[model samples]
Structure formats: C-alpha cells, structure tokens
Target: MTINLTEYGLKQTIQKTITATEQPRLGRVIEQHRELYQLITATGQRQAQVTGKLAHQATSATAFPAVGDWVLFSAGDDYTTLIDRILPRQSVLARGAVNQHDGQIIATNIDTIFICMSLNADFNVRRVERYLTIAWDSGAMPVLVLTKADVCTDRADKLRALADVTVGVPTVMCSAETGEGLEDLQPYLTAGQTVAFVGSSGVGKSTLINRLLGATVLATKTIRQDDDKGRHTTTSRQLLPLPSGACVIDTPGMRELQIFVGDLQQTFAEITALAADCKFNDCTHTSEPGCAVQAAVADGRVSLERLQSYQKLQREMSYQGLNSRQLEQAKIQRMFGGKQAMKRVKQRYHRD
Candidate 1:
C-alpha cells in the first residue's frame, strides 16, 4: 500500500517550506531512538540521522527533530537517510524536569492533546487544571479523556467536581475494556489530524490508544487495584498512523508534569474575566481591596482552593531557576532563531 504524505499530516503549510535546492527526500519522523530517527516516507519506514552540520548547529535537544516532525532528508548507502532540517512546527508539546534545565520536546505538529485521567484512583481535578493550563498554551485544542469509566461509581459527583476547572475544555469518558463511550473519541480521530494521548501512569493511555488502533500495537500494564500508580508500558514517544488516516502520537505517562510555560488565561477563564472588573489592572487577587477575584471567592463564584492552585502554578513556572520570562525568551529563540540570536542577546547585555 502506498503511503500518502498528506494523509500523514503533510499539510500545505509545511509543504510550502520545502525548497527545490536541498530537499531530495521528505518524510515524517515516527520515532526517535537516541540519535537514530525512524521516518515513514512515500516508500515505507526508514532509519535516519541528522547531518553533522545540523547536529553541530543545534543549541539544545528541543532544536533537534522530535516525533511528529516533518523533516527533509537525503538518501544514503544501505537504505539509510540523513536528515537536513526540521520543518517549522505548527504546535509543540513540551515539559520541564527538576534536574534538567532545558524543556523536553515530547511531540510536535499535533492537532489535539488528549489529557487522560482515570476515574477510579487516579482522578485529580487539580492535576486536570495543570494539564489544561499547559494544553491551552500548546496551540492545539485540549480534550480531557476520562479513562476507566467502567468501574467508576461516583461518575456524576466527580464530573461535577471537574466542571468548574475544565470550563470550555471538551471531556469524554471511555472504558478500554467495555468499549463504552469509545465512539466519542472518533470525532477527533478523523483523517489528517494528529492527536496525542498524554496523562499520568496507569490511567489507561496505551489501553485506550490500543482500542483506537483496533489492535494492541502498544503494550499495557495492569494497574494495581489499590493506588493507580502502575507503570506505563510505552517507554518512549512514537507517532503511529491510524487505520482511519489520522495519526496518533503515543507518549510515556508523565506523573508529575513540570510546566515550562502555561496559558492560565484559558484554564482560569472565570477568574480572568473577574479580574477585568478589579480596581487595579495588576491585581494579584490576594487581599487587595476591590479585588474582583477575591470578591468572587468571597461570594463563592470561584473556589478559594482553585484560586490558590492558579497562583501556585503562576509561581511554579520558574522552571529550573530561570524566570518565566527567560524561559519564554529561550523558547522563542529555539522556535525562530539559533546561535545568532543568543549571541545578539549577550552582545546587547555586554554593551550595557
């Protein structure tokens, strides 16, 4: 069967980036195992690596090709390929680590981000808020996938709890075993769209993806009935083409999501709207008089706990000792420029 690049998310916007001079081969990176990249071209799956110049020019790991990235490559001996450059990504999903300073690029050019959470022992509305914050900033739509719906006894209560925090975000409940509510996921899985499954461990990310794939392409580990801390079977990120013509990027479960940047405006829409009525434009919503957010909290319009959670996330965005502004500037440099921009910053600072 011939693989159609358009159906694999090679949209016209990305196709316009190709130049007649350098691009001899075009393919999407399906998986990156260390330095070797696995790409699916018009022919089939092929192994590839970045050119020495490309590798040398990269300033950080995120500058390299990630899964779901379209790349220009050249054919080599023994059927191997050498990647020349990565196309501009429409959307990027990344996370930060405590010990690690740079943000890790998990996937790129995705259409939707499925934030999975099991209803049984893994449900946390706070975590859902955190995920929504990160998702709203990703330039992709975020959908909350509530897994393990079959065994949940307090579905209504839990959903009611989540209603306030997940405002405007789509939520779906499905059971991988019973197949209930599985059809709800089909709308987002249409052709040419690439959706990613992401959540903490044992929330049934792989299981739900397997159900969507119509086969167990990924391994699943049974969750312990006690605390839903089961390990994920998929150890790395991989982009798989679904039979329906859409692509699915399966990622390893992230228990503690360290956010590099977030869009709290969408996640805390109610508070953001309330802040408009505040007497001060820069109201922190703490104890200031005429603070609209605090006033809303007093009248129960917004929960104090949720307000505090939002503030905590605001303070927590200082990833790896860099202020949020620094991290954002770093991201801008990674996305649009390279060593030249970094050098310019240093030169401007040194001149001052």
Candidate 2:
C-alpha cells in the first residue's frame, strides 16, 4: 500500500516508500500474557519482539512498543519482523515500574485515563493523588471514575470528595451493575480516540470496561466484604476496540503504583501555586514569616492536613529520588552519587 510522508516531514514520495517486504498495518496488541507480544496484524496475528539494534536500545521493556502502539514491520510466514520505528505517540500513560526505580510506559496514544477507584474500602485520597501524579506525567488528560456507585451510600458526597482531590480534572461516578454514568464517559471515547483504565484491585476497572463494551468482554470479581479489595481478574494489559469506534486498554489491577522521583512539582500544582505567594523566597511554610501556605491553612483556604500530605509526598519523592546505591549509603555518605546526585553536588559547589 502507498503511504504519504508529507505530514510526517519525510521527503520521499508515497509510492516509493511502499516496499514489498515491509507493509503498513493497523494492529492492536491482543495479549501481553507472555513476555512476547501478540500483535493483531492485517494478514493475521503474529507474536513479535524487538531484536538486533532495537533490542539493545530497549533498556527496559517500556522502551519497546506497548499495547495501542501503531508500528511498521516486515511480515513473514513464520517469524514476524522487528518493528523498524514507532509512530509518534499522541499521548502516553505511564507510571513507576513495580520495584524498579524507573518509569514504565503503561500505554501509548491514550486520549484519556480512567482513574478508577472503589466507593467502599479502597477509597483513598492519597491513592488518587498518586494516580493523578502519574497521569499528569504521562501527558494524557485524566478523568476520575468512581466505581461501585450502586453499593455506596451518599454518592454525591463521594463525587465531591473526588472533586476536592482532583481540583481541575473531570470526575464521574458510575456503576457497572446499574450502568450509571456511562453516557457521561462517551464523549471521550469517540472514534479513533484511545482510553486506559488504571487503579488498584477491586476498584471495578474491569467491570467498568465490560459495561462500556456493552458485553462481558472483561472478567469481574467480587470484593471481599470485610476489606473491600477486589480479587484481581485481569492479569495482563490488553487493548479492546469498542463497537462505538474508540479503543480502550485494560490493565492488571496494580497492588503498588510507585512514583518516579522527578514528577513531584507537576503533581501538586496547588501546593506549588501557594509556594509562589510566600513572602520569603526560601520559605519552608512550617513557621516562616509571611508563609502563604501556612496562612492558607490558618484562614481555611487550604487544609492543614492537605499541606501535611503535600509535605509528606514531597519528602517521599525526595527519598525515592536519592542517588545512592542503597538507603544506608545515602545516609552515611550524605552524598547521592548517581547522575542526578552528581548534578546536585555540582550545583551546590558552584552556588555562591
């Protein structure tokens, strides 16, 4: 098939770019069940991986193509060709990898992120904060989706709580059982758009997907009555196309969504905004004169607990961002020595 390169800034003509061995294909990742990915090619589905120079460049699994990525590769009878290049992503949804110090690309070209949370036992402002931080870092617009609305009491109260946490992002309350709030979510799932759902187990992520698909495409699990945590039903991240024309990727329920060290400033915009108003240029907001943040807490403009939460998150991020090989090394040496650590050291030395 002939392809145009004018939009992408290539000088080659459309017909010349089409090669016999290499073909352009629109493929969605059917399964990430194994280390190898099952890509749904036009001719048929094929198991593919990065090899040769590409494999060497992929420092982490996330560096390779992810589910929802449209790539160009050579087709074969037995073996699928390595993806030569990844098309520019419209958006990316990522989070800190489990137990790893780096970020993991959850999905690419996502238009919106459904920040799922349960109405019952798993409800947490802190968890939502983490999800928002990661979502903002991913460069995708985030929408808060509260599931199990049918079972929760005072549903309006829950929405208000999410609104307070999100501040600027959209929030919707929905239940798979009753199919509530599905219509509110439709505008974001228009044709050619992509969406991703992420949250801890028992937050009804799968249930919400099943409802949007208008069928039981994704498995559902019941939350424990005592603790309100749902058993994980989806084990791998898979992209599913909706009959309505959009695409959605369902991910495994995350037990621990760690934070990468550098996103602290972007995640808490409110706190950052308050800091700009402080009288002292280096005010810590604890008891500094003309502290805008502390003054906000005193005047009820901001909650004390909210400031405390912000401070706690900042500290956690600092700890995670330490450059030492180990926590003990950071404590004893008092100098983190990784690339970031060295940069800090140089900055301090050079400062007047």
Residue 85 of model 1 has an lDDT of 77
Every candidate's lDDT:
0.84, 0.69
Clash totals in order: 0, 1
- Scored against the true structure, residue 309 in model 1 reaches a CA lDDT of 96
Local error of candidate 2 at 325, Å? 24
Over 288-321, each residue of candidate 1 has an lDDT whose tens digit, in order, gives 8899899889899899999999998888774435
Error of 2 at 274 (Å): 1.4
Per-residue lDDT tens digits of candidate 2, residues 1-352? 3323221112122123334354445444556654577676656666776556666755455557777665566555566655654444445666666566445667776778999988888888778888887687565799999888888997777676665568778888888889888889999888766789999987999888888888898888788878777899988888877766777889988988766533455666777888999999777789899898888889887777777866766665535545446534422221121345445434544552
lDDT of 1: 0.84
**How many clashes in candidate 1?**
0
What stretches of model 1 exceed 4 Å from their correct place?
A: 20-24, 76-80, 319-352
| RMSD versus native structure for model 2 | 9.1
Residue-level lDDT for 307 in candidate 2: 78
lDDT of 1 at 239: 89
